[model samples]
Target: MLPPDFTLLQVVPELETGGAEQTTIDVARAVIDAGGKALVATRGGRMTARLEADGGRLAQMPVQSKNPLVMLGNAARLVDLIRNEGVSLVHARSRAPAFSALWAAQTTKTPFVATYHGVYKAGSGLKRWYNAVMTRGDLVIANSDYTRDHVLAEHHLDPDKVVAIPRGIDLDRFNPSWITPDRLSELRDSWGIAPDDPRTRFLLAGRLTRLKGHMTIIEAAARLKAQARNDFQILFVGDDQGRTGYGEELAKAVSDAGLADRISIVGHCDDMPAAYLLADIAILPTTVPESFGRAAVEPQAMGRPVIASNHGGTTETVAEGVTGWLVPPENAEAWAKAMERAIDIGAAKRTEMGLTGMNRTRQLYRVDAMCAATLAAYERVLDARRLTGKRP
Candidate 1:
């Protein structure tokens, strides 16, 4: 049991719809359920209301600013908040906020934790130094084994201080049993998928950006179409994030390949569980390494087969021929062949694979497990602080 007065303050850029923000809300719910106060300091977004509903308080702050002067002011403000709120621990999820939270935690003599949520690329000394703040946590959390290895290779830290904890999904939300047929029909209809159509729906979900391999998937779709394998429909679901040029390029590519009818680029989806249920196979053809690909895990939780690039967090989350298939990154031909294989697997084998993935997800990637591990880390830091009699 947690101490009644124990409080944890998590800092992030915004309460938005992403893996980090979702984890922030999950941990906040865990802290509350454990009889402790949970506080989040972030610029508000769509998830702010949900966070509050889950018993987490929002302390609005511009911790997202990267300006040196603004960051210094943020550090001072965070220190004041820590002291006034009697915060027992400070946790940060992004680099900009981590700097301020790190300074405040040190100044207030409070335990600090940081979650490495991205595979931060640093091609220069200054960038490397900026990225080093994540490794400065009293206890550093890596979202995957690949991420932990990246941290160990890039940062000079005691290996024992770094822990790899994969991001978890809320099984209650992603469960296939809870999603009704109406929900599936609603998503399919929104995507213009005909009720009697027998074509397999291949879904690639993420921001409509180059790094997500939208071009690569488009190329793969072209390859499949050229092979006269037109029994599949490829769907790209995500916001363009105001990248009109890129969206236009994608549409032109589809037109050039004569696959405009076979491929559709749909915008942001509100119900992911239903979306997953509507997909025959989910794809994550990323060009760069992901820290922890929630797209890979969420679909699996919904009992859908996945086909992700053979790299990064997907390497750990996806099993070959069991949960899903992994193809070479950025290779259209390879992706096309994999898609063919998925189609050949037929409905029975696909159901078997989905069942395997569902079981694996339940055993390893549930949100409750992540919360337990995170709280355990916090307890370690708090225990040390108690023994040393540290105070602001």
Candidate 2:
């Protein structure tokens, strides 16, 4: 549904590996498949080569800078690019880059779009004003209904201008059948779990941060141990992201609770599909609400039951008693109880739940579906511009 020779320019702070960066690449690939040009302007990162491989050209810009003068300069540079490259629309995925994109789009009389990817904490007036740039687009894309509602409540905007598009999972990459037993065994061996170990493995996959509830999961592990439930292992699979002090604190907590053997903080995993296959259950015990809980969905796509906190986007993605269970946020006892329930459900029932989750994710949260819907949104924006005589 792309226009002839259309060029869509997407701006983000960096091309790092995250949901936004991945989505940008996915959209870029989609644009190329649809016979359109895709341009990405960002401070280069690990995924820059991948973006280029997908037929998206990278424009180096200091869009990540928050300095007002730098942002103004970025705006001028973007305006020049919009004019010279014939960029059809400017789509921004982060607040800092969005400010410059907004100015450039307005100056060039081009359609501007923004995606709300996080529930940014706007604790002060100045911060709130800065965050408000996301809502100033010709059309605003919210990654989840929770994010959409948050945007509407926190900012004054026309309801029609906002659309909720949940982040999607790549099923082909997450399929259980594609994950060989040898891969699972290798990961299990690396994680210190015996291949034939009968203990239920609970995996928490995300950045090892306080907000991600690593401590909460550790506390829950302690409670499970106190309840004489020893036939289980809690694996924290993620990078600490330079939070050495916090990581040390969690290690100390595990030691203090006598869970050093039962709980292990396994640093960053690059092969998540194998990791999910190795786990009996996955958990997203986030203390803070997620704008869109990809941690919850990706495991489910791999036929693993997810135990997510009962808040934010998880509430929308997890079907309680069906695909997964939702426990109260930051409540260790509740999480412990849910873990017990998941273990008690036995292998067959957990398989049933996992199948249900896989089915639900396929129907609602496939990457192809998300990309198609986004392309449709872009088409709508272009159509509106044409009808209103804003574009010839």
Off by over 4 Å in 2: 389-392
Model 1: weakest 10-residue lDDT segment is 383-392
Q: Candidate 1 — which pairs collide?
A: none
For residue 132, model 1's alpha carbon misses the true position, in angstroms, by 0.5
Q: Can you write out model 2's per-residue Cα lDDT over 1-392, one digit (the tens) per residue? A: 78887999999998756689889998998888999999998988878998888778999999999999999999999999999899998999999999999999999989989999999989999999989999876788999999999998999777788999999788888898899878888887888887678998899888767898988888888888888887898899887666688888888999998998899999888799899888989999999998999889999999989999999999999999999999999998899899999999899999999999999999999999899989988998899898894431
- Overall local distance difference test of candidate 2: 0.89
Clashes of each: 0, 0
Q: Where does candidate 1 stray beyond 4 Å? A: 389-392
Cα deviation of 202, candidate 2, in Å: 1.1
Per-model TM-score on C-alpha atoms: 0.96, 0.94
What lDDT score goes with residue 146 in model 1? Answer: 97
